[model samples]
Target: MVRAPFLFALLAAAPASFAQQATLSNGTMHVQEGTTLRFTGPLQFTIGPAGALINDGLIDLGTQAVVVEPVGSPISGSGVEMAVTATDGPFNATAPGGLGLSLTTNTATGPITVTRGHLARVFPEGDPSIARWFRLEAPGGGSAPVDVVLSYDATELNGLSGSAIGLYQSTQEDGPWSSLASTNDAAQYTVSATLPAPWDFITAFDQDAPTASASLVARNGVEVWPTLTHGPLFIQVKDGAALEELDLFDGLGRLVTPAMHQRSSTFASMDLSGLANGPYFLRIGQRTTIKLRKE
Candidate 1:
């Protein structure tokens, strides 16, 4: 995915902010999870204890690679693999290392619109065997039913014939994963179910296969749209409370504090008294914020 914007308070607690590296006009810049962008320069976004930061060149991170994105540059990656090694930790990462996929663009001139309709999951954590857990959740704690269609590029791997693949969903990103869709072949799949509980879809491979090498796995490329959750509001939540705050930005993926949020479960209403009416994303986070547009 492209470098997104500020963090949503909801994402404040998540550790391990995945970093993405790409070169541009001004050297290398480090990026975190919800960073928004227009990098005419090289950037590497990394997330950790101190939070996410953008650096303008290659700094030696443990794993991962050094990707280059030149102006009008065509980006590509091969021998690309995610291997989750079986360790005594909470997650199992195997060979090839971790799962990962490169998010690129087809356009270079104007702004990019990436909605749930343009989400792609990159499993660069390597191979997740018997220990890969999945989770999902809706923004603003909005329990409204939304439909998300997830697809993956599995053409890079082989030997996954007859593998039982299914997607799981939930209101939270860490709970019992409910099955959304399933199949057994080599092709892109889609699910049309509504996640009333705020959800995410997980595609799983061989559940009990002993041979780790032959299990077929892939990343997610999904399209998500909130159905009954339509909005053109400005609001914020302050400890289970709803109020009006103006320090939010939208999908533009740039960082610049605007206003402040308050205590509200559904910060969906606001008064843009002095501001112009258009489209903006209400980004709430320590860094990676949830984006809601105001029109």
Candidate 2:
């Protein structure tokens, strides 16, 4: 059976704005070839093999992460392409490999506006070797920050235990590059940081090791084992106080494991076989949170 492509069009003639949250549960939301769609709140959309989101307008994702999922599509493997024309002012584009590139306001206080025809050029004579390059303009006299998140595939990164990645920012795009503070989420294959200033171009590459290591401390007589693991995770509490509640959350801040009660025991384990390979957080009691990885 042939499935017709689902299309949601926003024409320039109509010129609409979504002040609250909206979702495109299933289907493609096409921002017509020459039109614009402004989103003040969160905008969630799903892209499948037969669906796509082509934006040629000003989209403001606000403070929320734009969730992009591929249903029955190769988006998670090969990735999708988002072209920002020269006229498109300040737009953000995130790829399947967990790469989020965006040009937003300086304050980081307002919405990110992407105007049409705002083409970002590769720095330093447009190097052909660079896999991806983007150019962003600072809002007039004020400066803006360029944010970059380098995400890797868990299977390919070897469970994020021995892999290292770095994010570099450059003003000339080819001259000298400055390194930024990046947090590695081993479980989920992502390293991200925000550049302090507006640079010509920002890029990410692998490193020998992470700049900062995950800290393991004994809090409230409880300690989590194998900060980095490819299988089930173990937690132990020295004092035989039963855990009031336990919770597990994915990198995107979604709760993967529901709150559960545990009897007074020194040791407990949770199987991660059902969850996708990535970084997760295990919260014990009410405050202690530990990072865990699944391969």
Q: Which candidate is the best by TM-score?
A: 2
Tens-digit per-residue lDDT, 1-295, candidate 1: 3244444222233224323342233322243333333322222422323233342221222233222222221122211111211222221111111122111222121211111111223222222211222223223432343343333334322233324443333333332233333333334432223334333434333322222221222212111112112232333343443332334432222233433333344444433333433223233332122223223
Superposition error at 156 for model 2 (Å): 11
Worst 10 residues of 1 by lDDT: 109-118
C-alpha TM-scores of all predictions: 0.26, 0.35
**Cα lDDT of model 2 by residue, 214-242, tens digit:** 33435667876565555556677777776
Looking at model 2, report the run of 10 residues with the lowest lDDT sum. Answer: 121-130
What do the candidate models score in CA lDDT, each in turn? 0.28, 0.44
TM-score of 2: 0.35
TM-score of 1: 0.26
Q: Quote the positional error of residue 188 for candidate 1 in Å.
A: 3.4
